[model samples]
Target: MKKGMTWLAAMAVCVTLAAPAQAADPIKIGVQGAQSGDLASYGVPSLNAVKIVVDEANAKGGLLGRTIEVVAQDDQCKPEMATNAATKLISDKVDAVVGPICSGPTKASLPMFQEAALIAVSPTATTPGLTEDGKNPLFFRTVANDNAQASLTSDFMLNNLKVKKVAYLHDNGDYGKGFADKNREIMEKGGTETVLFEAVTPDAVDFSAVVRKLRRAKPDIIVFGGYQPVASKLLQQMRRDNLKTPLIGPDGVKDETFLKMTGKDSEGTYASYPKDTSTLPEYKKAREAHIKAFGSEPGFGYYNAYAAAQCLLAAMEKAGSTDTAKIKDVLRENQVDTPLGKLSFNAKGDAAGMGLSIYQVKDGKFVELDHSIVLE
Candidate 1:
């Protein structure tokens, strides 16, 4: 019996000896956004910024002594695909998430992330209702809500442009149309006459019908609330039909894709983007890192994404655990220095103290205009 017991003990020892040492599990972060498709320009730069932030963090020995791992899923800016991406991230055991860039996908993915009790910070996704509705507690964003953006845009139109009549247009998607609606409300409140308020089909190859309407209306300015693909087509059609009304757009139209698509036609168009911070040392470092990694300048949402990742990491470090509730508390209470200046989240999940600036396409590049965010 003693010999048998000794043999059994030896077998246990052998099994234990054969077992590999378990390393500390990595703290995985999921980057969910459009890595391909039409909006790749927006999402890819966001992912690049996150990657640079993560790489730097890892180089310094990842958070809480556990290495951080990044997992990205392309949602193509589609709602259905966003849920799938969120599911994949959850299955991959990610502790937190960074995006689902557009407002629609962000809205669609929120319930799933909520079910998993995962927290996500969006760099874009500016629709007001996303956070204002207060349905999702885990939601946060680095960009101001569409309300702020619309207010700024309206203020620009009412004060700077001083136009008597305005034409408001949107692609009819939640994000675009929501922005358009807000702008419409604010402009009307400011006593500006709405010459034409219309929704354009997102898939329409020709926008001449609407351009014709603008021509007939002869509005002082055209405000287009939509993204690049539709914006490019609409602008081209408008210009082709000789409609020279100044068309102002949202940040969705600020990408290189828009400029490349429209070329000379893109010139003189204005877009409201989050204020440029390239002058800041931190922003410059991030830009250098991005260029090093991707060999080009960062595009739309790049600064916002960098800020989002920095704030997320800062919140995680301050929270001292992966507990989302704790992290959320940290996010609300703490401020992090980002390229966009020191940023913290308001109760509505909008980035506090962030400013928007108007940029005009000049010489094939977006040039910052003198006027900027002066919201009341």
Candidate 2:
């Protein structure tokens, strides 16, 4: 009897030790984005938002009762580097990925994620090609596509601003060029003449040649499709060259970095974004939590990243497993409540009911237009 009791006590201790070990096996999440370079203005805030969401989820006993760990990889906003980051994440066995914030990087890295059966939810990659051709079933984004923003802006320019002749400027990257092309087509179809279409190497400090071309074209407005760094520089150079053509940019220029880079020159410029929700009562908790974790209010791409994390966690919980296939199916069939709103994906993995609002720079800040447009 004494021997049997001692054996039972040993077994109890073993079970106690093993229970914690089982619970400690973390569900790995990969965060792929530009941690450095000009795009960091957007990517860093997004990563901060992701951390806040994941930390909050972990506090309530992480997804599926397992701890969650983030495997962060910096792609520097480059395509090949993004592919390498995706490869590393696959090797590390991350259960899901949160980024590749730019469209080009996302495109380059998407095939690898699809092949590995990993769920990739991007907060910002808005190119239509991501979902147009049935490219990857496992990929999703919290934001609307560029087509919606471009169309809305084109309509606003024609109807509201009454612009006749416009010029197009774009960075040569996939994201910028795609956005510019879509906007050009829409504006032309809407009865606005495209006076000039030009591409500039991204990160170029001088726009003398482009400004000269724009002067020749004599456009009433210039639409730029590119990220903050290039957009800011182009605007500064435009002012230097005394070109008074009003410039409108896409979502890529909607960061605070643009204002900081262009100073007073950024005033009166325009950009489009999903309607702001940071002040709404529904997102009050999320906003406070983000500030608590990051020691500041969230910036560019914050809400979208939080929404992406919510989508991933909610899908994982609903599926009752970490299997990517199951989670993907759950994401398709179910709606997840996020700080942005209740979110659902369409057949193409695009967010349904997402839309855009045109914002103009007012006294060095972005303010909404009198109206907003929804993307169906």
Candidate 3:
């Protein structure tokens, strides 16, 4: 009888040891990004920023005493890839999802997220259609949309700089096309004439043809609705061909990589962006922490991604449960204090009371040129 009791006691100890492991299951969060495509610069850094936040959160005993696990997937800036990634994350039952950084991928994959009842917060997807659709209550974005940026950019070009005629160029993609359309609409509404509007394939290496067209039109300013890769090449080729009009662009062209790609040619280019880090104390502290951790300043997508993750975690904590419905409600109603300051979502899940800031590339660096111009 004593020998039997000893065996049972040993089994009890084994069960107790296994219980801790089972109780410590990591709360998984899905993170999707274009880790291997044209937009990798934006995706990779944003993923790294998410990691930084996850690490910091875990170090603080994690959420609800459970460690956070970020399940990262590469969407490669493709819609199909984004859909597959979203499906896989949904099947895996992640508590929340962070991105599909580019707008094309974000728009393509949003339906899957909605069907799966997952809370998705995009760090960089700024296309207006994502939130304006009125179909997906779960879709949220930390970045300002193209409509807001385009309005402010139009005002800056028309009212401030007093450019009466503007030429608009965009890469033929959802992001580029959407911003170009919005900018044209706003500029025309403000009584400014858009002399030339054109869309070029993002991979086009020869922009002399477009430059010739622009030169023929002879607008005072050229507004580019695209990211750095195309913008840099276009600007460089324009310079080589001696097209000397001032360039204006949206947030996609505001990164340091744009200057690096275009070199001296990037000088005098103007860009519209959300609030700069220099103006926020919380952002300054976050920037210092990020530099210390990653050995460089956080890029545009980095801080935004971190803020998105912080917002998700804050909502999770407020809901006190991993239930998606409760979490979504918490996200919509609660104000999250993140590295970017107090962020609150509207009924549409878009950031509320946010504005865009204008920057100018002077000496190959983006310098904040004006104060925040409120849109709504």
Locate the minimum summed-lDDT window of 10 residues in model 1. 15-24
Q: List residue ranges in candidate 3 displaced over 4 A.
A: 1-20
Error of 1 at 194 (Å): 1.5
Decide which is better by lDDT, 1 or 3. Answer: 1
lDDT of candidate 3 at residue 98, scale 0 to 100: 90
Rank candidates, lDDT, best first.
Answer: 1, 2, 3
RMSD after CA superposition, every candidate: 2.4, 2.3, 1.9
Q: What is the lDDT of residue 100 in candidate 1?
A: 77
Write out the backbone clash pairs for model 2: none
Candidate 1: global Cα-lDDT? Answer: 0.87
> What do the candidate models score in CA lDDT, each in turn?
0.87, 0.86, 0.84
Candidate 3 lDDT, tens digit per residue, 1-376? Answer: 9999999999999999999989778898899988878778888878887888888889999998799999988998788788888888888878889998889889888888888888889988889888885887889988888888888888788778988888989987888888889989988887888799999878888888898899899998998888888998999999988777889888889887787789989889998887765567767767777889889877768877888898899889999877899999898888866665678888887887555789998877888876567534
lDDT, candidate 3, residue 162?
Answer: 84
lDDT of 2: 0.86
Per-residue alpha-carbon lDDT of model 2 for 1-376, expressed as tens digits? 9999999999999999999997678999899998888789888877887788889888998877788888899998889799889999999999999997889999999999999989999999988899887878889998878887788788888888988899999887778888789888988888889889989988676789999999999998989988999998899999988887888888879888888889988889988888876666546877888778878877788888888888898899999998988998998888876777777888889886655789999999999887577655
